[model samples]
Target: MANHKSALKRARQSEEKRMRNRTVKTRIKNVVKEVRSAVAEGAKDTAAQDLNKAKSIIAKAAKKGVIHRKTASRKISRLAKHVNTLTA
Candidate 1:
């Protein structure tokens, strides 16, 4: 238990932030998975659409501090490559 009042308040704030961050993180993962699955199934149109969606979600997550900017960029790059391979 936090002894100081400020510490307790901070703990509450941290909990709120954690839940928000977790939701963003989960959304990003789900979008990425959707892209991957579409690519794996050789659905070029669906994969492209999903990849764009995942890229947007990842960029948003990075902006929100839920994920690192470099991490998001790398993921976008890799997914784009995979989707491109399916098209080409």
Candidate 2:
């Protein structure tokens, strides 16, 4: 329980931010899974498309401060590598 008024307000703001972040993170996970599944099924075209979508979502999350920029870049790089393997 927040004793002070300011503390209660801060708690409320924190809860809102947490929910927003959770939604973004869940979206990121779902897109990444989609990309991975496409890759696993050897659907290069689908994987590539999903990878692009994942990259955009991840980058947006990073820009929104939901995730670290480097972490987002790393995730995008890894997914791209997997999708590229289909080309090789």
Candidate 3:
């Protein structure tokens, strides 16, 4: 229960941000899963494509403050490694 008007506005903003962040996080997870599944299926081309898409999504999430920059970099690195391994 927000007593002040400003507090109520803040609460609303927080809830909106939370929902947006949740969606972004879910999207990130789904993209990562897609990349992993492609790799597991031995589809190097598909995996690489998915990795690129994932990298972009992760970077945007980091830029938007949904996730940490280092975390995004780590995710991109790992996905790239998997794609590379598939190619190699």
Candidate 4:
């Protein structure tokens, strides 16, 4: 219940931001899953490609303030490690 006009405007902006963030988060999840599946299927090239895409998306999310920088770095690291394991 935002009575003040400014408050109502802020609420609307918040909702819009929330929806945008959610979409970004969902995209991140899907990219990560795609990478994992490629790795599981032993498709090293596809996995590497997907990992690159995932890293970019995650870094962008961090830069946009949707996720923390360390979290993004950690995710990229872990995904890289998994992809490497598939090669080795």
Question: How well does each candidate superpose onto the true structure, as a TM-score?
Answer: 0.96, 0.98, 0.95, 0.96
Q: Give the alpha carbon lDDT tens digit for every residue of 2-72 in model 4.
A: 99999999999999999999999999999999999999999999999999999999999999999999999
Candidate 1 C-alpha error for residue 63, in Å: 0.5
Ordered by lDDT, highest first, the candidates read 4, 2, 3, 1
lDDT of each: 0.92, 0.96, 0.95, 0.97
Using TM-score as the measure, the top candidate is 2
Cα error, residue 80 of model 4, in Å, equals 0.5
Better of 2 and 3 by TM-score: 2
Tens-place lDDT digits, model 3, residues 6-62: 999999999999999999999999999999999999998899889889999999999
Clashing pairs in 1: none
Q: Model 3 off-target regions past 4 Å?
A: none
Q: Model 1 Cα RMSD, Å?
A: 0.7
